[model samples]
Target: MQLFNSRLLRERMQRFSFPAGGEFKKKINVIAKWQKSLRDSDLSKTKEISIQGLFLSKFFGEVLGYTTQADGKKEWNLTQHPGNDIDARIPDGSLGFYSSDKSATKAVIELKDAMTSLDRRQSARRENFTPIEQSYLYATKYDGCNWIIVSNIREIRLYNKSKTQSYYESFNVLQLEEDEQFKRFYFLMSKDNLLGDGALSPLDELLQTSEAQEKSISGDFYSAYRELRLKLFKHLRENNVGYDSSILLEKAQKLLDRVVFILFCEDKGLLPREILKRAFERGVSSFLDSDQRVWLEMKGLFKAIDRGNDKVSPPINGYDGGLFAYDGLLDSLRIGDAIWKEIVELAGYDFESDLNVNILGHIFEQSISDLEQLRSEFDGLELHTSRANRKKQGIFYTPENITHYIVENTLGRYLEEHPDRLPVIRILDPACGSGAFLNQAHTYLQKAWKSAYEQGEIKSKDARYGTLFDYNPAENDRTILLNNLYGVDLNEESVEITKLSLWLKTARSDEPLENLDRNVRCGDSLVQSREIAGEKAFEYRKEFGKVFEEGGFDIVIGNPPYVRQELLSPELKEYCSLNFETYSGVADLYVYFIEKGLALLREGGYLSFIVSNKFLRANYGKKLTGYIQKNYTLVELMDFGDLQVFEDATTYPCIITIKKTIPEGPMTFKYLRLETLEVADLRAELEEKGYEVTITPDSGGWS
Candidate 1:
């Protein structure tokens, strides 16, 4: 039977109008009444099952326009075991819609109680035990069934069994009352939309394409960088350049990164686009076919970028000489006609077309990883063996999801609490390998500034410490970038990459990056030269003195290096143990970083880090844990116990958030034990529960 008459359905939708402000309130009032009655019913667990059937099933069926079985006959047998009893594993209900000639089963849906939510642990309870998996199993068992849905009244998820990932879409039913969200809901579940393509709806196709585009951009950028690196390395080797392989790799990467930034600037309209392209083309032309000419042409281009707007070339505002000032860098770098042509071709790709700062950052990350791998092979070390060495140094980039969660909780929460301090808020990532945290913070601040401007909460003059003037979003972004966002890394290459990434994040088509070194620096953060009281100590102090003299950073965040004491140099290990109260004989370098981050925060400021969860119970962590308890307010802890947040990594990681001030009384903090990486859902659950526990100095260890 046809569940919905197409003609009538179309007419109904055409006549329907969304509710206005009062009308929307009225709808919510009606839902509130139903909720009150349901609570007053005092239903048991068994009775709640009936509510899922009587209310949820019927409501969704009517809304989505699906025909349901009336006699309670199972539409498909999913499990291998055969049983007729309801308790012996039966699908919730089967849905059918009219195809061209006849009614056909379109999807199978499984429902759970409104209070129950699906998580990875529940899914892994048994093979195909979760609602989504159960529906998937049924789809595989039955012909012509391609859609599977799992809902618990509160949240709904749809899956296409034929797809590799299977996951299609998910939405909270409670959110359907919102106008925009309601539109999304209707597009995904409307009878017309679903029946048009049972396997993948139009909305699904759009989402899939967006995801694919992001991946494509990242992949293409990496491919271009890889090609340039290989060609440049081959050219240098052929020319018998005396630099070691490590030095060669570093120089090549630096040159490649600079070229990419110039290309990006060109695409964003900051530079004359065709000027660099044409210059390279002329260098490789048959008339100037000598490899030496290519080097000279490239050197001229670099000189033009550094000097900006000379007598011969137009002024490129905001161009800095720091990035291009290496002694003999241009003189030593020479490329053949073929390599020059290939590099130019790679540069021709559009860098400003829907390319985001985060994606660009990931491209750099992958490029850096590849460079390290190549360096390891050049050193005669096995690839995997070299990777393990790097991991020990805590060189891995933080995954985007974890970074997003940490930033939202720490920096996002801080800004929310103190809106007036937006312009002056200083954020620092001391061990900022490639500046992932810094870049994310810069993006977040820009968005926050724009939002405040739109709301008329900020003005141009108001940004001048205390005065209120006309609001300019672009100026506000520039201010945020220049005044805020600080980072330091021991690796000079990482420091440069961080600056480049941050510059890329805030680059405007009309402006050039004039002074990126003001905020990001290269230094060892933990030990100051003065504190060491030796010849080496003075050098350390000179490097870090200015960073500390600025009244410390207002906010500090990073995934600090995880080297153990055994891996550290004798001098460094002795210094850390003597300087940091948290440092013990066997403490890891990350522990000292935690101490340093805390010391750097201003009074009442915040610090957050993702490090080994071993601090909770390890013997070496006792001093650190005690220091935190006595000095700061523990804001939140998310322990991903044995959950591999980083694929193939051995350590059990946890996120720690703390405020710089001491607690006046019993302090309650949010704690989570995550078994999977469904961070969005985990965050929702945490918010709903508001889990808090009071810890005191008298209380025993965290275990």
Candidate 2:
């Protein structure tokens, strides 16, 4: 019944040695009386006005260091008051803090009646006018306001206005008074924290703490994935399967990826919850001493998952079969019941609760070691080592931050200027190894569609934009994903993995997957067979004819392979020399991808690539540089000189954004010198001096 437990408040007061002055002490005592009055009231409801007057006013004035007029002692006062609609109709109340040179409203407070909880979802009728929405609206309107507080006496939510979404932190007032560790929460909303330009200091601290917590969580998740894979491999080996050590390793890696996907599906409610647990229990009882029987049962389950429920004896309605196409391999392999049980138990973690696809992608990335590391460990084993070698040959995956930045400035900015094209804009990743850029593009499209939907810009659920926001794959999500995202990779396995990753991204309960082959192809992007072999020769154009015939894509982005000239096959080397104007004897392979990507872009289409920075200064880059200056409008150039973008690698990476259009005059290219590895620092610098440099490309070089 107490507003805050009296003893806990007293302890906090003494521990922090908070102002024990006469007026503050009296104000605190008065707050306790108001709590008693609210608690003892016979009325079924307490209005918002009473809550504001009795509790919020005293708390802000005395505890949080805000000026207030004394009861029966004040004349006309000009100082701002923490009350409802203080210069804004949206927020319930706002507080203004002043400095010597400036005075501005620093925070907005949204209050509800004692009976109303701010955390609960409102009824459909009132959903649009929820407290959280109101707080966000007010914060957005006020240029100086950086904080939003929503409270219903019992629970309090604090949001940082600077975030994309203003939902940041929350707390229980009573719990804060009781726990000493919770005292840090005060730093977020304290008067001292809001002074001058230091308001965001506390938010920065919170971000650091949150980042540390995330890293710890990611480490744990990685360890779990690693342990599970090793155990699964050991079990398979013990069973004496026909495959040799090398084959076993490859199969083991694929099986581990499938198991992870299965776990993810279950967590996301695509599969029945605890389905793995039940399967394990049943196997233990039915196949008690028979390892072969357990393996057979597991094989059947995989087959069912692959063919989906419609084709199986006992259908699992929602699954798509491509991921489990290697069911024959599973049937041949024998796994012990105990091993099955351990794996099932491991999959039972609540992955869907806090983990998103982005985080899961990171976890999956850590599950497998690079080819070079793996080859060193398994000596004399003839593993499928070409993929690993390719990775080492500068086919590194792009980091999410870099991907997002490029996509935002290119496709994102394009869409903003041409809103009507959101539904039809086509995106391509020519050398999509694992579909990182494509996945990011899909995510961006989803967000854009969601925003459009919320703003009532799009009306029908059947609209092309609807596919982006549809969570259920049976709906339009899969269609939108397939129609919008196109990719090509040289490695077939990489193509399959890219398809799988994209499927995982848009997967929902009970949705059948459309054939992804049409969108994601496997071929060498640079050289067509006809170009090398003459008429009737093999060509990638025949495979990806649809995109080629359509006059190219609306957006093309990727981190292309960076093989050296010496590493290129004789046919490819000759083909590049004959066809590409930018080809030089010492030019790296990525240079060709750049020319290919440009060729595949329609006029005014955007193209972005994170490739070797050597093209900026190398002797062989003169042709490429000249070609770019003559043909494309260079939108941005982010040079990471000597800063390694890939982990444990030593290549200087640069991100270049260009539009497939000619420039009329000296174009101001947004250039950033990446002095640090941190993306945040780069972003901050980009905001300040990104457009400081300008250049016009002549036939020779940049001027």
Candidate 3:
């Protein structure tokens, strides 16, 4: 319970109203007596079942307000999940919903002795699920159940779970004497709220408020992030001399990237908790200046990250990737007291729990976008993620849902199509921004291989096989970056962030990070061979010789950058015309990505991209559409007309999944036109409501 599973639960706990007035004091007095009895007595030595009787039942009946059987017991009939096979009895108790005597039990409750932790396995088996996990499984499957209560007689926790999300709140019994602790526990679990009318209750109202609050809180991460980014920039700007503003921004970007990498590592336990903070504290304990402490610590920790710490008894291996490679500028700079302190604080932010991968990717993308803006306006007061800015640039970040959907339709299907347990396939994201699509693809592959191995579907333990991409607690970051995934981004920092993210995702304590320079490259994907306007080209045949030799990648996917047709440079347009038959003079920058992505795919290889839907009817999109229709198999087309799938942006986007195979008959494809306005559960919506349609790609304006 110390680790919050979701932002909704965090918000709910923070905002739960503390009960007040005279009546609340009386309830507190009763709770105090129970607390004293449990602690003052020898209740800690008894069996866990004793908790169901002694003080817990009384607390539930008198304070929380749940109905009990005639014998003062709660119901406990629950079936064990197949995967959670263990010799354990049904749940300890099932409480009536909304205090309704007529209704069946709709909430499951588990009890444990004061000595047992909530995470203790109920059975002696090592594979047995923990009590909290067991409770969640049973609660989700139990007829009509929406909530679960787990307690070790010393602390109580409530969980609300759905298929894709989980939320919960925990309160300690020892803190009951305090008004804030007691009130939140009482109000949220009290019979008056849980057993309220079938209509909206206090809990329901709180759910609504928390949902809105979650969005606001998410925005707060960026606000805090922007502040951190700007502060670091200002510090570097002040410290560095004889350098252009763009160089200052680049230095700032590098500094922030390292901080973000370490924060993520700390979150995942690859590094010690408060590593930077400890460094800062070490400076304080040594009576060093603020300017000296942060730089000294950050440099040391980063060095250790690059080269393992061998000073300790059990040496921790240093990461091998070029992320922490020597930077002459950073080495020479010394941050002042105020900026360094602020940075240490920001570094301590809980990146794992609060900023999930998708949000983290957005933070990176938006940070880079904003940082690029800062490059032009070094002294400008404003950084823009404004919708107007996005509209003008035709820029929209591909949300996780869209990325997951595209990956599934493309990469997921590719796996299913091949019966071999683990196929020798590589995935490429030609226009990879923050590597969101590549990250998702890698995650899917990891799970698929892990599940297969667990189910005994794969027998070989080959290092170069499934074991490479699969999670090997010891293998760490090296395997995932070997050859399975590839990325190409124009921005060098984007390439750096992509590697950092993948490394962080697969990082383990004391493991060396892999070098992914060849796998995830940085160059102009549109200009493959010769330079176009002095831009370095990521030539597929020369760069990925083996991939091209074996036809091409098994799957190519990404949300290519969107620049309006008018913005394409003259040289870029010339390159596209010379190299791509699908190119058009008025087509946007993304059009070239689609063409290049497909070109990188072998026959029957899958391709998916979520780009602007203007291509459906825009005059410039005719050649691209016709080329797709004539040369490839159109698998799916999801047209989200006018509905902004992004969080706070205005744009029309469509996901098109294609296969690099010549079509023989009618071009049939799965078609989905979003009918709903909400972005939640998009995969579910597409599956339940999407239908199929035939298309003539040669015709004008495919729509």
> All models: lDDT?
0.64, 0.63, 0.68
Relative to the unseen true structure, what is the C-alpha lDDT of residue 507 in candidate 2, on a scale of 0 to 100? 71
Q: Count backbone clashes in candidate 3.
A: 3
Better of 1 and 3 by TM-score: 3
The residue-by-residue lDDT of candidate 2 on 152-195, one tens digit each, is 76556766554422125566554554334244445445555444
TM-scores, each model vs. reference? 0.68, 0.69, 0.72
- Candidate 1 is scored at a TM of 0.68
The Cα RMSD in angstroms, rounded to one decimal, for candidate 3 relative to the true structure is 10.0
Candidate 1 C-alpha lDDT tens digits along 491-548: 6677788878877766664555647676777777776665443332323224445545
**Candidate 3's residue-wise lDDT over 1-703, tens digit each?**
1223354455666765554676567667767876776778876566675446555456676566554454344432221111222344456776554222344455677776766656433346322444665666556445666667888777788876432212357788878778667766776788666645555556656656655654565688778878888877777667766767777777777877787777777776777777767777776566664557657767887787788887854454687677887777778776665676777777645666666565577777666566555655667746655555555544467766577667756665676565352446788998787788888877666655554543455566555443533435344224446767899887776787788778767766756777788899888888865556255666788988988887889899988877887877787888788989878889888888898889888887899988889888887778888888889888888888988677576557888889988988768876779865543334445544677677664335444
Indicate the TM-score of model 2: 0.69
* Residue 116 in candidate 2, Cα distance off native in Å: 28
- Over 4 Å off, model 2: 1-207, 230-250, 287-289, 303-316, 353-355, 366-391, 460-476, 530-540, 565-571, 665-668, 681-687, 692-694, 697-703
Q: In lDDT terms, how accurate is model 3?
A: 0.68
Q: How accurate is candidate 1 locally (lDDT)?
A: 0.64
Error of 2 at 468 (Å): 13
- Report the poorest 10 consecutive residues by lDDT, candidate 2: 1-10
Query: Which candidate has the top score in lDDT?
Result: 3
Best of the two (2, 3) by lDDT: 3
